[model samples]
Target: MPRFQYRAADANHRIVKGQIEALHETDLVTQLDRLGLTLVRASVVTKHKRAVKSLTQQELINFLFQMEMLMRAGVPILTALGDMRDTAASTEAQHLSAGLYERIQSGETLAAAMDKYPGIFSEVVVNLVSSGEVTGNLPEVLRELVRALKWQHEIAAQTKKMLMYPAFAMTVIGIVVVFMMMYVVPQLTTFLLSMEQGVPIQTRALIWVSDLFLKYWWALIALPPLLIAGVVALAQANPGVRHFLHFLVLRIPLFGEVLKKIILARLTDTFALMYGTGIPVLDGLGHCRKVSGNLVIQDAIGRVIERIASGTSISSSFAAERLFPVLVIRMLQVGESSGALDESLKNVSYFYTREINESIGKAQAMIQPIITVAMGLILGWIMFAVLSPIYDSLSKMKT
Candidate 1:
């Protein structure tokens, strides 16, 4: 189906315009007619779509919440979709709702249409919706999705906030340092040289640095992007290098700890969601392996899957891999014993969430002092270099 952008007037004669998807222009016109709207103009919207809007975590959560309410109130899928569509304020949400409506109208399942936008909806979401439709527990599953997405979004927001200040500080400091070396220090050094006296060692060193910077300023400007590109190219060309880079990322001091915890939380959250959908443990782990972005974890999952295939339990396999923290392994063991693995995975998610939050706070606190000290040291060195010659000239005159 293709999406069409259209302008129309409703019963109140108010103009409405938005993107809608359908099989053909006739199908869209029929949809508009059903809505009691007269289409004034419509055209197929086409672009080389490089990406499709996967239902956002927030939008999915909202959809779940609304669907739960509507389903509990005895509303059908089509009716619920329409209600949600008309009520959606954001263009993206409205567009998705419209797409969903058209999909249902065309006799497709919700999950089937959602499959078209993998970026918007994850595999876990598709599976959950499929299960909900099968077990007639769509309302309950939607409620769970709302809870899970909210938790994930909150953690993400905290992580971003924790990083923002240090990143900004580093950028500002870098700009100031570059400016001093390239412009300010060079101009001051010229005046000092004109004094017809030997410059101090500090001044001499500064002059040399300024000259070098002036000569290779373009190199300094181009180095960062070029280095980034080179690294990216190598990573893409070699799986070993890519894995090595990911491993290095996980080992970086403050930021690395937070990142690891965040990834763990996401993984555990997904596992818990799949488990809740009545998926078999081994099958859920298989899907999780496909979705895990970290190669190290994916390798560990490969090993774990092999063990599970050979009749070892989830906890035993996880323990053998040693990929999970002790607490996570213990939780899995308990869940296996109690047959409440979903709840256990949820616990693991919460534990990592707290860890990520604390790690972020600790990282933020450490980064501030470290960045401030670094900036101060760089500025102090430049100042000493620029002022040393002036001080030397003044001393000779006084003598």
Candidate 2:
């Protein structure tokens, strides 16, 4: 699709200028007319180029929060959209509001219009809005959407924080090791070799490693990033490979359990939100399968869906997979028997969220001391290797 920059006059003869995507200029003009805008000028812009970037999570949250407030205050949806379009602080927000307003004016539903911008509005969001539209509960749904987005942002922030220290520690350790092998050890080893005494095994081994590193310094510097890029590209290109990588992450010690809990927390949180918004259980599960972010979980959800479709109970289907914890399975069973699955899912979400927080805190506390001990060992080896021969020389002089 080609994008077009256009200036037009609305039904009230107010001038509006924005960009929209269409098949051609004619189609762009038609879309403008449908928005009740009289096209004054239009020019096709290049594909894949936009004047504005995508909206950030915070920006989207603000937009939804404002929209909810306006609707709750008795303002019409179109009026609220138009006001937001004009007053938006960011170009991304302005463009989104304008596009959505025009689409709604052209007789498209809000959810349908939002579906056109998958980058900004995820499938989960669009489905929730569609349900809200159907039920005339758009304001309430939007509030819940804001809460969900905020919770997601917080979880992401915490996860990043949890990983930051270990990543930084490892990177610093790598740099120190490279510096020692390339510069420090070589200098010290030359002096040690100048002595009459034979070098100890530790010193000899250290020298061998230094020589290897100095000889292949370029490869040492380049291989890590290249390897990481290759792995990421391969994962993206192959579903099986990607799934395996996700599975591998979940099996890792200490960190893997935290990652699994995070995924489950997100899944249950989203499930509760969608189900609370009047989406069917099966439909909610289907949407969750797409957004699970873990192939293993997705496959598990897919199997659950199939089981439900084949007349199996939801709780039984979940338990049959054996991927989820016993607590989650029990909660689902209780929800199913009591006919309050949404509330049960909310409890599940809360449980996992609390677990993730505690697990992350403990992991962080444990990692710092572990990293310190590892660094101490490496430094100790280098010192002992470099100093042992010197000690031997002193003993010879005394003899």
Q: Which candidate achieves the best TM-score against the true structure?
A: 2
Measured against the true structure, the TM-scores of the candidates, in listed sequence, are: 0.83, 0.86
lDDT of 2 by residue, 1-399 (tens): 467899999988899999976645666776787688998998887666343457899999999999999999999988798778657888788778877876787899999999988888999999999999999999999999999899989989988998999899999998999899888998998799988999999989989989999999899889989999999999999999999999999998889999989888888899899999889889999998999888998999999999999999988998898867898899999999999999999999999989999999999999999999999999889889999999999999999
Q: Residues 146-236, candidate 1: write the lDDT tens digits.
A: 7877887888788889879988998999888778888898778768889878777877887888888899989988999999999999999
lDDT of 2 at 268: 87
For model 2, the run of ten residues with the poorest summed lDDT: 45-54
Q: Give the Å error, residue 334, model 1.
A: 1.7
lDDT of 1 at 289: 81
CA RMSD of all predictions: 4.5, 5.5
What is the alpha-carbon lDDT of model 2 when measured against the actual structure?
0.89
